[model samples]
Target: MKKIGYLILIICFLSCESETIETTTVNEELTAQQKTVTTNKNEAVVIRFIAGLSEAEKSVLRTHYGVTAYEKCSCGDENLESWNLEAIHEGATIEERVSSMEEEPEMEGADFNFDIQIASQVPTDVISGPIHYQNVLPKIRSQKASVTVGVLDTGIDPTYFRFQQPFLHNTVLDEETCGNDFFGWNFIENNNMPIDDNGHGTIVSYMIYEQLVNTATDFQILPAKAFDTDGKSTLFRIGCGLSYLIKKEVNIINMSFGWTTTSSAIIGSYIKEAEHNILMVTSAGNTGENNDEIAHFPSSYPARNILAVTAVDGEIPPTLVPILSNFGPISVDVAVHGIGLPFYTTAETAPTSVTGSSYASAKAAGFAASKYQEGTAMAVFYHKILLDKIQSSTLLQIKYASYLDL
Candidate 1:
């Protein structure tokens, strides 16, 4: 009887091991195939699934479908047995499958919304015209002439025509490998060179340079790479990136990335650093949710040295705020053009249009840099100039050109 029991246990162990090995092989194969199949390169797919599965059940599902990563809910609960369906179905049409799945009653309230859209069209005349500089540049140009504004977001496309003569100092790349000290680096590629694989950083860079700097008169940019292709980053990596920028003593730092909340210690450190006369500019996020209810870190931190900005659309008049712009009486300090903003693409020849609070933050940073002056007094001076501009504008006026028509 004992020998019979031992034999049954041995059989179960071997069966489990076989399943594990099979699952590993399947995952490896799927990952290799996913790399080759591309769809909606601009959008990232995150899968969500129902929870409350036993260990055996999860293993069975993973082995059966070869699942590798589990997507988490906004509440931080892990949804086991989920997969990036887009990746899993690579090369094959899964729209029918997705449609059928959506029809199921179990998924009625469990469905995830992937509604983020990147703007594709911008006013060519506005982008090509020199009116931006003629109207806005002279007021703040002399103040920012010598200030170093660091952009901590996606890496910049150095070859872009608009930035052909940008005052860039890269903090991402390691000096030993790139041979140049100021070129940006990418931690994702494990290299010193930080060229943008995604166009988000490039677009943000141009908005700051072309609109703010070119208009302001004489301000330069310091490019700092932070987020990668997926538009995801952690507080630790952000801290490391900021440390590099601090060492450079940049006059202004623009950050377009943030989570609902971040470590208090990290936030405090940033404030302390800002007190040293470095102005920090950040986005108010794009969720369109109430920031007071769900405070975003870095931006939410109450620091006198930091300025939190929200987005506005350029299609509106200069005095009105953009409809999509996030606002809070306390959290957001000001608003700027955040939608359908023109910027250069990775192609290096012509410009592409994109939008987000990321662009708004860059605009604010560039505007501040353009008016930057040495000493704490100068820092306060530039901040006031920007704040005054925001208060003078109204929402309706911000989205229409008629306000500027006069």
Candidate 2:
């Protein structure tokens, strides 16, 4: 047990209009260098409704729309008249069903939805080598961290030696708060035991842990697990997870996963609401595409509190190497050393080599926690402290570096 901490989170609140964030593509269409998991389910559609429903109305849904089953994400005030959810129908794909709901006059009047945010997985495997844990990073500030980072992803392995005891923060516990025995909220199972079934969460956790440990920063990790063994966080899950983190009042959030969508009002509402409260650090994704063209939330979300982090490789100075991380001079705020980095996993005996913007964002989270100025958090505060913003269009785009450089 190297540290100790505490937790709460509630989700986005906004607008009377129902929504359909079209997360249609998996967005992993990359070269042979990049690989990711793309998931497409044809049976259901996620919907966000803005009206309070009665049993009579629910019955009508069952009788008319064949809504055999539905799960609602109660991420906001129970009194609030909004329901983010998904339902299973008899036939047709998610897209078709969403279209059907919107066109149906009765459902439209009953608070129908738009924008389909499909799910996606990040690029896990990368070029590899023997894991190395013996490097002296240049920036080691005397200042210890005085914040909590809510990690939204697959849960972490508390069984791991590093994750046990004080590593996990304890929060107010009860029927409404985090259970005394758990690390954070598990949206996947709607419980407090957010143990990592998939290794993605552990890898991301390990990165932030290592950075803080090596830097001698005092901090706690709040595990807001929304993804499970399937390693996917949909719109509803993300909302539930964000709801948890916000309630916890974490200083920083590390989101190493994303989905590409144009109309992301569902997710954007949260981003806009949390703009002045919490600072969000997210991966620009490993798709190697320009984020300006393909908006990846909540990174691509136009918010002052959200930062889109990209990945770059090689030692600083003369050896910089570009990898497959997504980037846009405007969309992506900065870059970090995220290529073929060494990380640990609970499923494996020792550390392994992996690449993706996920690790980059994790590193950036630690950096933000180290540099976070207590007071009102402004995204531009971190953005302005860049060591040097690259200006040469013809030169190598290696201008990005860890905030420690400054």
Best by lDDT: 2
Q: Which is the leading candidate under TM-score?
A: 2
> Weakest 10 consecutive residues, lDDT, candidate 2?
131-140
lDDT string for model 2 (1-406, tens) is 1122121121110221232111111112222333332333334344444347665765575455556566654443221122323454466544555566556543322222322221223333332222111110111112223777889888765444454325556453223444333347777777655666655676687778777777676777878877766565555677667767877777888988776643445456666767887888988777776768766666778777887777766445312234366777567777776767654433334554666778878888877776666784475556643533443332233224332221
- Model 1, span 1-406: residue lDDT tens: 4345334534543454423100000010111100101112222222223345565754564444333444332111233112444444434433444444444332211122121222212222211211111121112122224567777765655554456554554222222222323344454343444455445566667777865646655556655565665454443345545655665667778887665532234335545746657888877676654556667656777776677776665654443243445566667776676665544333333443555666777777777766666775745664464544633436422211111110
Poorest 10 consecutive residues of model 1 by lDDT?
Answer: 21-30
In candidate 2 the C-alpha lDDT for residue 364 amounts to 80
List ranges where model 1 is wrong by over 4 Å. Answer: 1-145, 170-180, 315-323, 344-352, 376-379, 387-406
- Candidate 1 lDDT at 14 equals 48
